[model samples]
Target: IDVDKSVDLTNCDREPIHLLGHTQGFGCFIALRFDWIIAYSSANTNDYFGADSDDVIASPLKNWIDPQTLHDIRSAYQASTITGRNERLFSRAIEATGVPVDISIHHNGTFIIIEFEKITDDRVPEDSFVRSMLSQFHRYSDSQELINSTAQYIQFLTGYDRVMVYQFLPDGAGEVIAEAKNENIDSFFGLRYPASDIPKQARALYLKNLLRVIHDVDSEPVPILPEAEDAEDSIDLSFSTLRAVSPIHIEYLKNMGVKASMSVSLIINGKLWGLIACHHYSPLIPSYFVRTELELFAEVFSLELSSRLMREREDESNRVRNVHNQVMASIGSEGSLLGLLEKQFDTMRALIQCDGIGAVIDEDYRTAGTALSADWVHQLTRYLNRQASSEVITVDSLEKVLKNYDTSSDKIAGVLAIPVSKSPRDYLLFFRMAQTQTVNWAGNPEKPVSFGPNGSRLIPRSSFALWQQTHDDRCEHWSDVDVRSGDSLRVTLLEVIIRHFQERSELQS
Candidate 1:
């Protein structure tokens, strides 16, 4: 916890989420080989199974559970192993104790780890709960509404002080789009956090593991017993919901004044698009029943999110398609590329999401909207043709690529261009004006100072002050969908050009 002492900041990413060799104090962790021999235990199995940790380690799974239970478990375990899936066994109460426990089986490549989570009965049917959540999703019209409901629902279920839907931008940085919190806490809605706050590997881990909980940052981590000398001997907990957290992250959370926290992954297309980040101002841990409910809710919400996002993309694609058809129709009738292109200039610029567009064919040039001067456009077009790599070239910063032209950045900061013909140097280009804006960050997001406890090692920054930056060289960002639309338009233009050439040849003959 010493800020002056140095620590290897890189280890935050290399901490091996899979082989953490520990568990958060919410469950009994037991590991067994494929042959059913016990490999390791969390040393706290007595609280759950009435057996000593050492007694369970060197025994078979059949010693504690009945044969029927082991058979059911082994069969489910074997099936999941083949499919690379996880399965939850039954929930049963301890003999004469009335304490309910939920068991789940998942493989970690080396051993099949079984977790026994002590849970309280909520009496809510799984199907009913899922249907209720899904029904709520279908009622929402857009992603923003759904995210708002999800944050509120999670906050209600977990009783957290604040719950926010943290979505990642094109860059690794994140923004809180939807938030639900108690009146006492300050709002973090719309606040942007730097990418380094959650390192790259940590995000990968969140994708692999759906949920992670830190019950109390102040509690000491309970290390795995008989710690092996070699790292290979350690048990992997990549799929573990109760894996102990990293100390660096603990300090990071403490700096934010968050004593406890949990995150539910919001995945889209097998990738992490966002997270339901819940923060607690004080130590508060939900029972396994509540945790399980929130995890299920997140899964259902992710599917709905994927569907909504696809619809939005399809809407954009349809708009581009309409403009493509309109432009093609005009060009087909006129046959004079410059005349037709000038007539449909506004629609073409809209297709590319740009304010200006320019086209050149057989030395006939046309410009519209906020386009640069014709002379400058002609020079830029010639330069672009010489340096062209593909049929469609996009540059977010044109000045960097075209260093010879210092005056070009005033009007044409970014460009998306498509080559219609090579011999005549014919092309269509969409230009975006220079746009500058402020970027807010959670912290400075720089490399940690090296003068710490471990000889000149990297340590986490202690202050989480709000930092802002102003940019000048960058223009409006381009999306993959935008590039695809441009690519499709290029193919259409090529086909039209081919047909136009064929018609001219026939007339000449």
Candidate 2:
């Protein structure tokens, strides 16, 4: 009987019956004695006949077995079975049959856990797996929740620490969208990293190596193929999995206090959207089988997220196209134009994920929009005039460009400037919360002190709460990207606001 039990075989009750056990299952056989006993991957039990030998399987078990009885059993079994000339040979032939038990024992009573090899999808239809995965995505597409349900589903499929959906700005800065993580871990939902954190070179590299796993940052190095050194651009995976942890990156992670890292790229419309970062508390090297499984899962997630985003953007673009036509018809009517253009702020707010929404646009190209505050308007007008002069304009760092602006107002930390039309003249401006907030973390701000080979002391990390000195900084603590599904509540509220603007624009126009 090809009996298969999910529980460890050694833990099963085979009492009162003499048993022949091998490898991990040998423990059960040790509790009973039969007329004749045949064991493999087991140790002699003379030292503690009544005691468990699970801890000392490394030593020979020959001491416990009666030599004459063992010899007789070996001769009889070999004669009856005619399996092979030697016990080791028989074990090898059995293992070649792809049976798990073969790896559990050898005739000499030694145990060896065969290095698990690869699992090919050829044994299972690839199309069926992909189709099954797509079926899982249906729940997300059918929902109206603004939270990154797409990211959440991916996290479920791939067992990784908080699978976060991160949005990367052109300058390398990024924000977390959705995340799910271990309950004990403190969230990094709203934390922001400077553009320098992910340099241009790193971003480019991600395009080709879409998935990466850095397990056991402190593990010993596995050298590459010595003969392949002459090939300049060759990628050798032979021993890459065993490569040593990078010193530079170790220091980088130590600075961030991240022990393990795995990342999958999210591409939308052939553009980089963000990444799904999986973190671990200790060294965790996943086998190739697990890595492939995650990659397959991530690919499905990227496709779904891209498809959904494209559909939504298409709907918005179509609405905008129709609305623009209506606004043209009512160009002379200021109230109609105001209603038609009122949604500009809402759209900008959605894209940037801001707290406050405000816009400045000309009524028939006449006046600017309402001022957030008297001081805010003054700074905005000057910035708008500067935008008018540039033929081709794109604002990368609004904080740096708008330094003269009064960002000190309320919770406004960032601004979104969008040109209303192809013409570069005075255009629309939106205000909102900046991605990075000023916070006063509870612990020491300085990085941990380090002791070098020569015992040199290192400085600790910075923990000053200086970023949160003002009222604006206390508004929100963004979650790490993957765990932001709970933030759907905010997105739902914004959807209503967006609907209001869409209705007013259509009706008033």
Largest TM-score belongs to which candidate? Answer: 1
The TM-score measured for candidate 1 stands at: 0.74
Report RMSD (Å) for each prediction in the order shown: 5.8, 17.6
**Per-candidate clash tally:** 5, 30
TM-score of model number 2: 0.49
Residue 426 in candidate 2 has what lDDT? 34
Query: On residues 162-240, what C-alpha lDDT tens digit does candidate 2 reach at each position?
Result: 7676777554556665677878878767555433345454565465446666665554433221222333322222112
> Candidate 2: deviation at residue 424, Å?
16
lDDT of all the models against the reference?
0.73, 0.41
lDDT of 1 by residue, 1-509 (tens): 23332333344566565566778887778888777878788867788768777777878887777666677778888887886756676565544234577777788788888887776455553432555667777688898898898888778767899999999877566889999999988888987775556777789988877888899888776666656676666777778767888766777777678999998898888889999999998887776556666777788789888898889888988887797787667555335867766787787777777868888888777888776567677777777778755578787766677656542346667778888877756888887765433344444445443333423434344322211221245456666766888888888788777776676777779
Ten contiguous residues with the weakest lDDT in model 2: 16-25
- Candidate 1, lDDT over the whole model: 0.73
